[model samples]
Target: MTTTTELSELTGDYVLDSAHTRIGFVAGAAMVTKVRGQFDEFEGSAHLDGDDPSQSSAQLTIQAKSIQTRNQRRDDHLRSKVFLDVDNRPTISFISIGVEQVDETNFKGTGDLTIRGVTKQVTVDFELTGTENDPQGRFRVGFHGKATINRKDWGVSWGRGLVSEKVTLEFDVAAIRQP
Candidate 1:
């Protein structure tokens, strides 16, 4: 089925449907190959304003220890002090400072992203895929977003030669309106 939604009609508080959402990343390795990974645990919420998109906001927190690359050894290394240092810094978070609607289905979210112990401003362009009512009678909105960042800025500078400094993050999110 086809669905369309206007930003003015989406004003509400929503909770991310983590079961259907994905937060993943890609980084070049050895200047030749690319490594992909994802965080398995996260929670987020968003407040959208129909009248003024700039008033909308979102926040997300991800468990650093939950990083998965499909390789046990590599994943373990990433959780070590050389990378995420999950033991000392267990959570990565983002809080949106502002949002701008580019069009009916596109938006730009600017925010501060905290990783390890450092926080940096980043912007993610998001596309509102659609909105639908599930069989369970819940209204859901779906979005896809992406942003690129330098991992070194976040103090994750261990893999100088083995891994690329630039990391691209992707978000596939589905949120349900709060009652």
Candidate 2:
């Protein structure tokens, strides 16, 4: 996995290989500790216009019901109206509005993130970790990105004292370029 490839060679449409990717979050719990979890199911796609970094775009959709924190009871509560309300809003999505190249391996994307029907602007900083040709002869690209959001803004404010409002969202994306 070498990230030294020319950006121009990566221009194409790519689909996220969810099995090799992870979308997770971390939040301060009880003002003393942290709770970490991840969504097990998600799909994403990206269009990379290597010639023009600003023309690059990406979109991601995560199943709200797939959140897991290693505890079934807590997971059920999270899927209820108190948190994601997966029954009412089964999906969380992000659509990139703009992208900028901070350098060769660093980039930033500004976009609209929708959670439980509420949409807010957020910026994610991405690191182009690497690109490689896998054993199956498929072209793969890897990226790690992160962003922070306020749960209260998305209508998830039940645990005011138990869980902090700010949450850190992390992405370990593995995408395959379309033939």
Candidate 3:
């Protein structure tokens, strides 16, 4: 397994800290309102080898029902039929096929992101927030990743005029190194 390290540092496996991580999605409804929500139970892992950024990989699993918003009614509607059908897909996931260093704290990686039973290639923009050991000596690392895609491309165009074609997905998943 891989643990946390520097961009120019060594590589290993790190287990995601579900308690400290969040994966959010925001989509525009018409030109007046926006719909926002998040997946509740998500786990992510990254395998980064200092020698080969190309060899690095990432994977994330997000529970659908965890979706939420400022308004409860709207959130319910989104989870119902107008948007994500949690019963059908249940879980949204992203499995990385490749990763490349854009610069320090930045990465441009290509992966297959699945939402609402639709999978498409998406280039993720990620930033690492360094690593630290807890009082128990367990190493934890922070990461923030983002990407945007056309809802129509993935058969997810449920709300046309009410929702924007472009959906922005962001992730703030923190993982710990388990020795």
lDDT for model 1, on a 0 to 1 scale?
0.92
Off by more than 4 A, model 2: none
TM-score of 3: 0.88
TM-scores, each model vs. reference: 0.97, 0.98, 0.88
| CA-lDDT, candidates in order | 0.92, 0.94, 0.78
TM-score of 1: 0.97
Clashing pairs in 2: none
**Between candidates 1 and 3, the lDDT winner:** 1
Better of 2 and 3 by lDDT: 2
Worst 10 residues of 1 by lDDT: 1-10
Model 1: per-residue Cα lDDT over 112-177, one tens digit each: 999998999999999888888888988788899999999999988887798999999999999999
Best by TM-score: 2
Candidate ordering by lDDT (highest first): 2, 1, 3
> How much is the lDDT of residue 82 in candidate 1?
89
Q: Is candidate 1 or candidate 2 better by lDDT?
A: 2
Top of the candidates by lDDT: 2
lDDT for 167 in candidate 2 is 96
